[model samples]
Target: MRMLLQIAFIVAAGYGALVAAAYFAQAKLVYFPAVGREQVATPAQMGLPHEELTLRTKDGVRLHAWYVSVPQPRGVVLFLHGNAGNISHRLDSLAMFARLGYATLIVDYRGYGRSGGRPSEEGTYLDALAAWRHLTAERGIAPEDVVLFGESLGAAVAAWLAAQVQPRALVILSGFVSVPELGQEVYPFLPVKWLARFRYATADFLKDVSCPVLVAHSRDDEVVPFRHGERLYAVAPGPKSFLELQGGHNEAFFFVRPEWERSLAEFLDSTRPVR
Candidate 1:
């Protein structure tokens, strides 16, 4: 009987430890100032002049970004990248948007690249807002001239911003419905819905957005399940479109899917402001 009680106690203690670890690990899930090579594409490579930019956040964190200008840019794509890597990791995507006649601004969230500040949900949201302000206030780009393009974790930030700020359109790539939902998916045994600290509840904010939305997800996305993207599209209260492609989390662009580019271009074309 004593041995049985000891075994039960051990099991209970192990379960408690696992729950505690998951709760504390939420903040450590996203790494800032991502490690790896920073790839910058030249005009010849992307068919546009790309300028590196450094902007200051409200809290004085200097964030890194790259602006690529297209000849007759239909609209500007404010590219909020995925959880990992700095802007350099997304040069291919920047080039693709530039080639499709859209000026692109790829900004690094605080703690990513050369940007300062620890990466939390709130911190990333603030970093995105700073990028928006820099383009609109400092560079003279109107809200109507900008499209928010967010990938994975960046999509949550974009959704939150769209709820607050009016933009031409929003694009969510490889995105989840909410951070807590994702946590539950990852740690099915844990009480993620209750324990998650940084709740990037994008689905909750979708109802407040008034602009057109485009959701792109890979059919076989391993990191974020494809259903989350579909669910978000269903909840968004706007003229919305969904594009499903082949590939996994990071390689969705590698297939050079025409639907991916066409959907974005068509959405921008439809939302362009009348002169």
Candidate 2:
């Protein structure tokens, strides 16, 4: 009987340790590295003059950003980047939007680049709202002239923002339904829903957003699987579109294939008014 009790105690302790390890490693596992990459392309490389801007959140967290303008600008794209990198890592995306004749404002969330404050789900949402206010209130850009583009974790941030602001259109790339859902998928043994501190519930908020949406995911994506994108696309309201690409998570947009750019351009064109 003593030996049986000892064995039970050992098993319980091991399970407890596993849970603790997963809880502590949650943030680290979710956000990857942003440093040690080559400098991102600049507007000069793309033959454009872009303005650098600093925005302050209501909570006094300052963020770094860039605003690139295009000839006969179709609209403004408020870019919410993925979890791992700062705005510099997304220069290619800005260039793509510029090529499509849309002004792009790419901002780094809290705890990224020169941005202030540590990152949390609510904090990132606040940071996105601050960037939006800077563009609409300070720059005088109307809501109807803005497009929200979010990638990976940024997709959740963008979904929350779209629910509140109702932009001209919304785009989610490599996004997930919620952090808990992602956690459950990665660690099936753990009770993720109970332990998760940051719940970026993009799926829960989709029903509230009334604007047009475009969700893009890659079949080869290993980070956030394509099912998350499909689920988000399925729950979104009318006038929505989905694109399945050939590359992985980060490379999907970077591949620069004709089909990728063509699909994006076609989606953007669909937003225009019929003459």
Candidate 3:
């Protein structure tokens, strides 16, 4: 009996140590900034008209962005990308929207691409505000004409920002309910609910959003579970739509192009302001 008690004590101590370590290293696990490389290709290289941008965040962090314009654009899309990679990596994806007659502004959060400063949850929220200001305050675009499109980690950021502003539509792809909920799935044995540092409460934020919302997710997603999207849709208030996508989480974009394109155009058109 004594030997069994000693073994149990050892197991408990080891578990405690792991939890403590995870608490400190959580941010590192969350933010994976991509390695920088020479810009060998661009949207223009792919036959799209694009302009490079230098946007400053609320806290003075400079961000690198690209504004891909389409002739007689229906509206503007403020794209918040996934955790990894810079805006250049997503140029191809953004170009698709440009071809569909919507101008796209994809920005690399600080510490990614040529943006200066490290990333944190609060910092990213500030980055979203910066993007909105660049559009409304600088470019003279009305807040009602802008669409917020958040991908993966960016979905949470976009939802948080949309709640605070009156964007025409809020769209999230491969998103989750909250960071702590995801942590619970990843580290079930640990006290993840109480331990996670970043609380990206998308569901909560959506509750307060005044604009239309569109959630796109894949059932075959290997990263974020499909149920997370469903739960989010359920909690989201007025004028919410879901794009039931197929294929893998990352690859679903290619498979769902028809629905993806049709849904967004419809959403934007339905919410288009009278000139």
Across residues 149-257, which tens digit of lDDT does each residue of candidate 3 receive?
9988999999999999999899888899999998899778889999999998988998999898888888988889999999989988978888888777667254227
Write candidate 1's Cα lDDT for 56-126 as tens digits.
Answer: 88888888788888887888989898787778777678777876788988888887776767787778888
Give per-residue lDDT, candidate 2, residue 98.
80
What candidate 1 gets wrong by more than 4 Å, as runs, is 37-47, 252-255
Candidates sorted on lDDT, descending: 3, 2, 1
lDDT value for model 3: 0.86
Top candidate, metric lDDT? 3
How far does residue 179 in candidate 1 sit from its true spot (Å)?
1.3
Q: By TM-score, how accurate is candidate 1?
A: 0.93
lDDT (Cα) of model 1: 0.82
lDDT of each: 0.82, 0.84, 0.86
Task: Please give the clash total of every predicted structure, in order.
Answer: 3, 0, 0
**TM-score, one value per model:** 0.93, 0.93, 0.95
Clashing pairs in model 3, backbone N/Cα/C closer than 3 A: none
Error of 1 at 45 (Å): 5.7
